[model samples]
Target chain A: MTAPDPRLSINQATIKYAPLAEALHLTAGAGITSIGLWRDSVEAASLPEAARLLAGSGLRFSSLCRGGFFTVPEGPARRVAMDDNRRAIEETAQLAAAGAPGSAAVLVMVAGGIPQGSRDLVGARSMVEDALAELAPEAQAAGVRLALEPLHPMYASDRAVISTLGQALDLAAPFAPAVVGVVVDTFHVWWDPELTKQIARAGQEDRIASYQVCDWQTPLPADVLLARHYPGDGVIDFAAITADVQEAGYRGDIEVEIFNQEIWDTPPGTAIARTIEGFGSAVSPHLLQAGARR
Target chain B: MTAPDPRLSINQATIKYAPLAEALHLTAGAGITSIGLWRDSVEAASLPEAARLLAGSGLRFSSLCRGGFFTVPEGPARRVAMDDNRRAIEETAQLAAAGAPGSAAVLVMVAGGIPQGSRDLVGARSMVEDALAELAPEAQAAGVRLALEPLHPMYASDRAVISTLGQALDLAAPFAPAVVGVVVDTFHVWWDPELTKQIARAGQEDRIASYQVCDWQTPLPADVLLARHYPGDGVIDFAAITADVQEAGYRGDIEVEIFNQEIWDTPPGTAIARTIEGFGSAVSPHLLQAGARR
Candidate 1:
């Protein structure tokens, strides 16, 4: 059997407690080949310095954390949001230009939620489509594939109106390959019934921008803002989902993006080590050993 | 516009704090047209006494609480579990037979969860199918239309492996309409991406057995056993969901099924009254308006 690819990518949020340079160095030292950095982290350390650190560490950019909150409702505020997204696209392009070769890495898109005082989720979804249409040309020029992340339904009201992998696909369908795609986060969509079908659809459409892993806790807390489950801590069927993604022909970085207070409080290195271990124990066994191969 | 139907149905668990006969009397006095009694409640009250209370109160039977634990793995224990489900089906038949003409109701089925020490969710699902096949014929003879309740995926481990309406439909698809159908409960499936599609499918397939309502909390607790949101308390796009159900031709009692510690602590009368109010403000506006226009 061929050796398993050791391209473990660390999401900046996993070590959000650490400074960007420190986190990058930590990830590199751990021998992880790739890293997914947030724009905020890049902003905190000057982009040039952050780029220098990546260059020194020899870490390939898996993806730029995000660049799409285009679901703002029509009005002055919407224009402002669009302007902000354009700036984000420019920054993503700059990062892409500075990073390793190939098509510019994915610019993860998180469709923003319903505007204040609006109950129209469908309307918000349309707003995202319109914004993506507006931003498509610029994104294409930058050579960055926009990865639309469908947040969990719990965040549908205030985070991302695009709340399903299928819904994200519908939004991205109208755009060209480089202009629009999707980010599949396990934390958000581990419970979806059409998960396998949607992932297959994503692969067929060539819209597999990123694949993330996390768990879904039961007895979810009353507050939605703080609700998130660590990768192996909750009850998501990760093994089956990963297998489906692979079957769909997606050979991208299986990014581990966890949003947990408990994990976040720990030291960045410790968290990364724990996450790496969790990924191996929870996912690798299933992905690596299928049928009677074991 | 037509007046909305007000046939209140008391799920035995609603007044679990009270004795079964007392609950029946209280619900009857509240002018409810129907009542749902759990097997445990009936057993605790003595089946004959429970039967007498139902007869005396002139309450209609909306449904027998449940009958399905086929996911228990193969063994002596599995046989015992199946036997228990069969007995539950027999009791439901007895309840239906004892009811007045046009008053007999369906038997709600909570498909069992993954068997102990088993991680094979799909295998557990097959067990449910086998159990349903065995029980369907008996249920048909008893005049009980088995209403398979698709529980939340969070309960896939220990409560019910049938976690989506679509999955439930697939399970019920092979059975005769009278032998098997579906109960769409908002609490369990509010987060489903294909909810509208599945509800439409259920309607098209003529498999809708009951319509139930509840809300989903955000920070889902870590514990699986004690997490539920009351109607109108959480951020589910309920109006849109029920509208789809209505368009799909599901016309039934929009039962209020809340499993919350706060609500449970309140007096049954207060809880029922609150449920009625919440149901009206949160759900009825959408459902009743649709009914009115019809």
Candidate 2:
């Protein structure tokens, strides 16, 4: 088999059923050099233990799966959400420190949906800003970058209010790039008309903290959340988007973050093999040096 | 029953099963003064007969349901699509002439999805531009505004390539405002961060040809295409969006267009009643003159 692209990172969600040890082992066994960790599996293994395992695998920790969702109204619930995010920030720093050199101390942030029973989308978005104000310093202190992810507009009302790269950049503007940055997830943003320009802007602003890859095709599964696919499995033009990200000067690990149930049901090793193959064909060539087309 | 708002128009798709005559009768029977016609049902009834029936119902023609889907590449099929759109434009003119005074000559445009088997979204989008450029003059000659509708991003790949009001306005910029304008359907664009500014821009540019309303809720059904809800029944803030349209200098009819399976299954009269009740409570107060809250 062709060696995995050095830039390929297996976002753990692709193997949703894998336990932490198995996920890291399967990813590394497939010749992948990096992995992004989700909170639950990491917490199950405990921060210190997860870090130990990651270090043992000799794989870079590309990023922590998430840390936002603090769109609740100001109250005890909001406070609890903020505290959970603080712990996530700490976990991110610890894991990044334990990984092989070049791991990114980035925590993906999914701005929560409009607050329950509320029609105030603008209000809910402001709460994301408020949460960022409250957490930016905590993240900076922990030496972690809060990578704000702008989910697709389909999820704007029920999953996340942040729905565009331009909007994410606007929210990140007030903070230093190291403390607050944006994620360029192909699955979530491939539909944006402003993607090319916004990505260039993100590069100039130095706010692109994470670069994740996946594909989007429709007849989107009943549970739309699992609608993502392996890179070449859908119609997303990875060449263009990947070239855009590369042109933006993002020379970071590219995480393959699929969320389909069919993918999850696959054996973790087989899934990682598929991911490596898909990435090799769909994304890696775009990352190669001039005239080095795969 | 409270009178339907004078600005309100019943788009026939809300009662998807209704024949043209029944849709017109049900709308006028329920005290709604305006009705938007879908091309299929209009053609089914024969445009002349449908026009005669609409005249008898005493309902003003708000706009035509559609005249787009021209993203096909240059070929006989593409020519067919363009010809079909021309026919739709003619039908819009005839129906408007047959309706009561104050009817609008507008043809809604839905930019077709990416061409079959193609992953080039940008290319597909450029096809939309090419279509507008080709058809704008014809539309102008026909005295009908081709109102571009920006479907939500979820449908960007397979329904409409135009996914934001700003993009619609940009596409409409090359032609006269009267020839190429935009449709602001709340269900599709309510998630945009740039919505408020874009609406203001559309007003200044005089491109707000139509304003449609429907609520958006989560757990979208099996066929997400039919996920829209009545105004007050879901989480969309109609007051804010309706106010934005009003402030944008859009004094034209506001169409209530929904595509919910449940709504379609309801008896046409009952559904129109619910739409009226929802609009009365959710959108009317925002449309009244200063201090004329309903």
Candidate 3:
């Protein structure tokens, strides 16, 4: 098979069961030069050790899996969520610092769902704005870009309330693009009618922190959270969306972030191998490659 | 229980097993004065007999369940869909003529998803636009309003490419509001950040052809199509959306079009009664009821 796309990053969730060490070794061994990590795995291996492993693997740290979930009403719970985000911000900074050259100090943010037992969707969304205003400075100080990821509308109620790239961009507007950016994930926003316009807007604003690739298919599995598929395996037009992101001027690592149970169950090496093949066939051609060239 | 909400319409899909005679009987028997119907049930009863039964029941026809599904690329298949929609338009005009005063000659349109095995979403969406342009004049000539219904984004790939009120309104813009309009269903659009703005826009354009209400709950069913619930059974803020629709000048029959399997299994009478209770408790208090008062 062709070598992994120079810009391809295997998001840790694609090999969910693989711990930090194995995930790192597998991604790097597969000749993938970059990886995005989940906080749990990093914390499992402990930040310093995870950083040591990442540095030794010679992989660029694309981003931390997540940091934002502070949709709670003002209370101790809210405080706890804020503290966790601060810790995540610190983790992202240290990890990015320890990675090979070309690493990005970015932390993906999934705005939390509506508060429990409450139908106050507007209130819940406002809470995300409040959290961003509170966390933006801290993230900036840590030299990290808080990447607001607008999840698919299917996950709006239970997972992430941010359901459109436009909404994410509006939230990120108050901060610098390098401080608060947006993630364009194919699986989440591929069906959007405003996708082309919004990708251009994100590019013009220079807030395209991460461009994730995956596919969406019908007969979504029992747990919709695991409904993601590798590039080219499902219906997402990666070429179209990648072209949009490329035109928008996002010259960054393109991460394959599938959450399918089948992919997670596959041997890590095999999973990474499939990712490489999928990316080479479905996504790499559309990329501008200036980032890789640099 | 308190009297059924005066403006509430029991959409026939809420009682899927009920035949036309039975559905009309259950709806009118429960003192529910209005209903929206599915073409399958209407066809099953035969149009003349169905009209006779509806006239005998002395109930108003809120709208027809659906008409549009012509997202297929230009072909014989697309021609069949357009012809079918024309028949649906004729049926809407006839049913409205047969119903009690205030019956609306509205045929709801669900723009079909991406054509089978075709990843051209934009092209598929254009098919919906083309279908509308072809049918709008015919519908107007028949005194029928084609209400473009934007299904939840989850169904964008396989059910309807029109997945937002804003997009539906955009598609409906080129036609006169009386000929082509939009359906504002709370379940499909409650998560949209621009819901209030779009509802106002639809109202201002005189294009609010139908106002449908249903709750959205998490842990969607195995068959996500049947994931709808009674208004009070989930996290949807009915008061908020109902008030928005009310303020937008949509003082028409509010339909509760549920698709839950358990609700479908319930006796039609019980289902109607439950819908009455749900609408009264969750939706009625917020409605201005000027239409009912008139």
Candidate 4:
């Protein structure tokens, strides 16, 4: 039998309960060739050790989990966020250097939510644009692309002001596609009505940075932030969306990033196995269709 | 002392704890000229008696709370929803007849959530369009317009598939403005980046059916559906949104409709008072600004 698609990636956060090195080892052991790493876990294992582990595992880094929260209002706070982001970009460059050729070298950017005590959403978004303009040079210099991720509209208040793929692409329009791009995560964007047009637009603009997949479940856990489910467990049309993204010319890792507690509680190896099983059913056909579309 | 700006209305669902008669009495006593009625309370008191109560109290019906759940796929279920909407239109006509001239006589339509066991959001939205086409003539004959309300995207999966003001306006495009229009509720739309443009579009199209206001709160309650807060209690930019809506030429009632446990737990009188105070602080200035812009 053919091995599980090498391009199928498991974002470490999907099994966040697993320690970074263990998640990486388990992903490689499961024959998956790619994994998206989170900075928190990378920082927790010391970057040098994390680098050593990745080099040994042969797992490609399909984009770093994140590095953008530029919504703070105070000058000092703003500087601190930028400083952290710059460091994140440097780390992303290092991860990319360690990965095999053609692996995703993108650094995902989740624009932070509204500033404290501020009702100015437009103002807050402007801050993100200003922040991105400031960071573009640093990202380009570091050889890391900034992938602006548009979280679901539900998170517009406290998680991200960027709530739609079109808005994200628009924000990225000012920068070079290599310096700035957008992340299309099904969990956050599946409900968007303008998704089809936006995905195509992202393709035409050559700004599709990372394509993440996870299903959206409702009654969204009390801490809705962590409520994402495995694909096929919820109502998303994975086949259509994957096909659309592929049609958009995103020839990159299909990263599964489920954030549910139950999945995290499972044994790491079991979780990865289940993730692969879900991915095979939910995404494979779309990849073939996307090839046909081209 | 200026009598709650005659156009500032109260949707009965905002103070759902109050009985139909008592809520009306309180609204009229408060000097608020309009109140949007809900079917449950109207039915509880009997529609005819409700009509008498409205006529006697000198309060106008800004709009009936709602009537549309066309997302149900079953043949019997679809017929039931259509029949219910027809009755709702009839009720809207009766309420309009009871109110003083110039009062709102629109039926608010919340396109229902996705059907049980179906992940077809596009199909569900199409069902709403078909339902609206069938109901438009009925609404026209009754002299009560159908106001399609685009609920927040968070409600897309379960409460309303129509998740944008633009989509709502698009659905209402085929019908006459007097037969079908769009409702802009702040709680559901404040996060939309396309809001200002959509509000202007709705106005240009003469599709502004009702303008409702409620603030969006976070760490949303376990029952996220009822997590909305009173104006000024959350993160929405009421001034900008209200100003934009007013700028769009919607010379209609600004109905306050919050769904929250804490607000409901408060005494109805206190809740109404708080809502009015919140509205004055959060929304009134925008109305004045809109007038100034004109």
- Chain B TM-score, all predictions listed: 0.91, 0.97, 0.98, 0.96
Q: For this target, which candidate reaches the highest DockQ against the unseen true structure?
A: 2
Segments of candidate 3 deviating more than 4 angstroms: A291-294, B291-294
On a 0 to 1 DockQ scale, where is model 2? 0.84
* Real contacts retained, model 4: 0.53
Regarding lDDT, does 1 or 2 come out ahead?
2
Kindly give the number of clashing pairs for every candidate: 8, 0, 0, 0
Q: Model 1 chain A: which ten-residue window has the lowest total lDDT?
A: A285-294
In order, the first chain's TM-score in every candidate is 0.91, 0.97, 0.98, 0.96
lDDT score, candidate 4, position A192: 82
Per-prediction DockQ comes to: 0.25, 0.84, 0.77, 0.71
Q: Can you tell me which runs of candidate 1 are displaced by over 4 Å?
A: A1-5, A69-71, A101-104, A113-119, A215-239, A281-294, B1-5, B99-104, B217-234, B237-239, B285-294
Judged by TM-score relative to the true structure, which candidate is superior, 1 or 4?
A: 4
TM-score of chain B of 3: 0.98
Q: Candidates ranked by DockQ, best first?
A: 2, 3, 4, 1
In candidate 2, which residue pairs clash?
none
lDDT per residue (tens digit) for residues B140-184 in model 2: 888888999999999988999999999999999999999999999
Q: After superposition, how far is residue B1 of candidate 1 from its true place, in Å?
A: 22
TM match of model 2 to true structure: 0.98
> Worst ten-residue run, lDDT, model 2 chain A?
A285-294
lDDT of each: 0.74, 0.92, 0.91, 0.87
